[model samples]
Target: MAELYSKARTKWACRRGMLELDILLEPFVDEAYDQLSEQDKLVFQRLLEVEDPDLFAWFMGHEACPYPELDAMVKFVLDRVRA
Candidate 1:
């Protein structure tokens, strides 16, 4: 996956705004995934890949994230990173 990511570097590097943050987050995601369940891993994968308006909502807990697949991960990542 790293090689694929490397090949896609140009595309990812050109991503705008917070999406660029996701590119910086790849390493942390790898470290964190070691402790996650298979189901949660799938959720994490989707959370990293998808761009939804509510994607970061659950992180703040100011609004509820309706996407069942990513809500737990959004919360978990927020708790882990504290931001």
Candidate 2:
């Protein structure tokens, strides 16, 4: 199904090398993406364009991401996980 393929693509993209990143991203992609606004979805994909080390730092709270859109998306994902 087309829907499954879309999810597969998202899953593959979410597979950042770090296990910690994977753990945070995978479930969020599966469970929360569909509920996101179009702007938020774009923000999430933009977040994926970031390097793995940067993602690790941002997602782990070592530092805030420099991009406002990316930071908001990261926060959205983190909030979904915490909730």
Specify the highest-lDDT model's number.
Answer: 2
Residues 1-83 of candidate 2 have per-residue lDDT tens digits of: 33433656878999988999999999998899888776677677778889999999999999989998898888889999878
TM-score of 2: 0.88
Error of 1 at 79 (Å): 0.9
Model 1 clash pairs are none
lDDT of 1 at 15: 50
- Ten-residue region with minimum lDDT total, candidate 2: 1-10
Quantify all predictions' global Cα lDDT against the true fold. 0.54, 0.84
Error of 1 at 51 (Å): 1.1
Off by over 4 Å in 1: 1-20, 56-62
Which regions of candidate 2 deviate over 4 angstroms? 1-5
